[model samples]
Target: MNESSSRRLELVPGGVQLGTGPWQRPTSPSWVLVLPQTVGLCSSDLKEVRRSRDVRSDFGHEMVGLVHSSSMDDFPPGLRVCLDPHVPVTRTTAFSETTLLEGSPDQLRAALPTVLDGTPDDRAAFTEPLACAVNCAGKVLAGSDVAIVGAGTAGVLLAVLLRLKGCQVTLVNRSPERLTALSSTALLREVPKVLISEVGTRTFSTVVVTTASLDDTTFDGAWRLLSRTGGRLVLFGGIRSDWRVPGTHVLLDGIRRGEDVRELELGGRRALVVGTHGATGADFAAAGAVLAAPLPWTAGHIEELIVGRVTLPGLAALLNDAVRTGVDPIGKHMVDIGLNQ
Candidate 1:
């Protein structure tokens, strides 16, 4: 087989640059090389523009791929599939020409059914995050008043899940574009920037922070949004530990009276880093179930948020400009790698 050559997204010091590279074939029997069909352009992709190069440079875990080759019989050549990156096996990078989907020996059993949602392959790439969305939604009780901060991938998906699960969800975001896009499905009430500033003033039984950054403004709002007693704060976007905040280890549930995380605790309130409980293979399966099932009238069009499809190189430009200008993309950008079987 010829060596694979493709455009790869590489993280530079302060931005991402498109670089041509060669992907050598995997020699390990445990690795199965795949060609990514579609990659979801996530908010994290914007963060990667400035993220340290040392951090993993892979972009778009939400993807569908065609098996280029495999030593494992289950995933033979030409099979189309999506993967659970959380699973140890098949956690390879998504943007590469020769993508490796690794799995344990036992996992490589007889031919497994290709994961599908009765949608197109590119649309099915959303299953991974939708799965994580399922995991996050399970944390809150149904019909509970929940506020989801951030209208990015995680936030949007969580909003859909909560709306389906009967929670009164309020979707918050700084951008009117995102808010308008989300409100089209009426999956949840959309909070504009003006209203979001006052989100803390209103009380909620649950507050889920999905921005992934706990900057002072966002943190204060989230802390204030939680109910005084028995209120829960679920970190859909995990907290970034700051030395000023105290310990490296964070106590999600219950209060710690120590100097660190003392102020973060509210009166008898509980905290949870959502998805901690159900990030298992079963959770990924649950995500597919949610997608396949007939959803509520307002919550079924999650795929409508997909706005544009660009190539990997074009995505580099879009993300770089987004990071530089501090502007968020209008909607999800699905990168088409032309990796058709």
Candidate 2:
């Protein structure tokens, strides 16, 4: 394959288009990285394509690649960097390897106090998702009993991180298979107490919902699991617009009874309702710190979370499979863009 050639999986009117093109390279000041097709198979990537109006949009954002070339003085060739796809509005640089360059002078000054003393590449490709999980976990108070409503990659990672913070975690999912997969993770097993259940009836102090398929039943189930006054619920998943739950039951039993049923509070015990958004630079930095530290989970447990690895050439096929079956491979799917793959 030609290094200069462009390869993309475009969404056409009826289906997807995967092929090569003579697409123009980045201009002089802009940098280019050869993101392997492997990154596009993530659940987040699939969700973007499903919601996009234009099928021809670029889909893979959580990607890591060697710097092909750059006109910027700060970034040079052969440096491994992960792209911060969501560059903040106030950013001066177009992109950074791991963190976004926040536009505000005060925010930049705040970051000065926490910058990690490591090279960009030391933060691996998985840093984005890990950072997001870490940020969400931070929102929960220590020792709070937490229930995560999805068993996807982010949900599982969040469960582990919350456990690290001393929270008892009960992973709730529609699929028993995902719970089985979670039980196999050594990281998850090391937690003080972890209960995996397809059925959630008991109320908890806090619940984090992070699944894509949130319907009436899901909402009902989540509301049923919150404590009356101090219960908090955080929505990390993108809920469909068509979803609706009868407010009568929740209002009469939950709020009316003083079971607050409120949003999540990060630093305090207050409940907080989080909007669905991509991770930020601060989130990325926090995730790096966790990944850099040694995980207490066993190797087999970590391996159980890895579903499979595919080369760039096989990405389009894997995505098509995900859409068709509505079931992803057991855990996480990694793509290898390097020549060795």
Candidate 3:
């Protein structure tokens, strides 16, 4: 094999830059499997990095790769595994990915079962985002009246998970088209629902915001969606730092500057603001477990969420379209990266 065959997509100060370099096939400890990537891509990978005024950033966190070589006892050559770009490895594990690169080793990693079975191509690539949505669902109390504000990928998945948990879910998004599209899902078809604009006089026990941009309007919308007392607002989206909120409406969590601000009660209703940086390795593993179980929706029904797929060579062009158009890919964008391609 030629040493210069390795190709990687890099973010540069000017824009994205693709570089082909030498990639060493692991030989040490002999058990480490160097699976060639199959497919990988995600919305977060396409987003602009914060404060990277001059530096380029790496993207594409979601990926399914095969075990090409391995010295580990559990992962043998040709075994299929999901590449968890977030967690790093610290110790040897019989059933886990031994060499960690993204997150700490104590973090959890999971194998891709759907891929192993050779079924849904999109499902294999969608594990990361689905796991994230599942993790968000886990954070909320059971059977709570939940309002998912954002009909994009995460919001739709959250609705499905909440329904599985026996919660009454209401999907609220600015776009009526998106809300309508989500309403067609069997997971949400029978649930209580309303567009954010149509939520004239409705409120929920919990409001989860998953939009890309968080502004004052987003806060106001969340406040309107929450019930007066014991209502909680969970921030699951990226927001601008200068976004402001009414102190009395909700308590802010993970806001660095809000430490001194006291919580306030509105109309005898107390609001709690919860902010999570991102999902942990355990969270991703838990998500995989959910995927391994009977899907919350039928395979045919869930397939409606997928927007499209792109080859590894064409990923840059598709991402460029997303950036220039300011549109979120409805379901997921699968990236094919196998050598056969």
By lDDT, who's the top model here? 1
TM-score of 1: 0.81
How well does candidate 3 score on lDDT at residue 204? 85
Per-residue accuracy of model 1 over 199-294 as CA lDDT, tens digit each: 556788888877745555675677677777667767666444331322234443222111112234433445533433225566676776766645
State the lDDT of candidate 3 residue by residue for 142-221, as single tens digits.
Answer: 99989988877778778877888888888888867766765667656776666677789778888888886677777677
Give the range where candidate 1 is weakest over 10 consecutive residues by summed lDDT.
253-262
- In angstroms, how far off is 105's CA in candidate 1? 2.7
lDDT of 1 at 72: 71
**Candidate 3, TM-score vs. the true structure?**
0.78
> What lDDT score goes with residue 305 in model 1?
68
* 199 Cα displacement, candidate 2 (Å): 4.8
How close is every model to the real structure, measured as TM-score?
0.81, 0.75, 0.78
The models' CA-based lDDT, in order, is 0.64, 0.55, 0.58
Clashing pairs in 1: 89-102, 90-102
